[model samples]
Target: MSVTLARELACARSRLFGLRGVTIEQGRILLGALEACPRWRERPGIGELRIFRSAAGHEVLLVPSTGRVQIRVAYVVPPIERFDAAAGVLVELARLGRAARRAG
Candidate 1:
């Protein structure tokens, strides 16, 4: 049930990404950046849907990009009750990307 909801959220966010020309591969990059957030981690576990909103109000969505046997989550070990933490990580990831853009 929880996984189902997460998937739905990911799907919704994916649609928003379409408007930005974001693709699954792009999502992977964003996800990688997100994992760099302070105190985050992902181990081989169950699948999950990572959700967030970009500063521009675009949804930053993510789904575990690995198989159940090789589950990919985030840098922070997810607390079952603290799922929202993932969103914050996404914001941080996006921020890093934007900063890099400015620097470049």
Candidate 2:
């Protein structure tokens, strides 16, 4: 097989095997989007906050960063436009990461 084909196969296998980790990463990103953005901290205008399962069978929390400057929860898939949100969620994740590291 060509190197490209082999790489593709490996990529597919990695995707299948690493789904759980991917979901956790997504969750952390979502969480970070809310935490990093100070605007979403105090009032959190339009965004909502809630935990829900993704279609991929992974658990994640949705925090919308729209409308006002709040981390609103929508309890659904795709997490609205969260993947593109600012670093609020990630900022929070950093703090959590530090806490976890300390605990560990």
Q: TM per model? A: 0.31, 0.24
Q: In model 2, where do residues sit more than 4 Å from their true spots?
A: 1-84
Clashing pairs in 1: 40-75, 40-76, 41-74, 41-75, 41-76
RMSD of 2: 14.5
Q: Write the per-residue lDDT of candidate 2 for residues 27-91, one digit (tens) a residue.
A: 45445543543433333223365443223333223433321112222223244343322133334
State which candidate has the highest TM-score: 1
Clashes of each: 5, 23
lDDT of 1 by residue, 1-104 (tens): 01211322232232211112344554555566545643334334324766543333334445635311111233233334224444443345557656544544
Q: Give the TM-score of candidate 2.
A: 0.24
Give the poorly placed runs of model 1, Cα more than 4 Å off.
1-82
RMSD of each: 11.1, 14.5
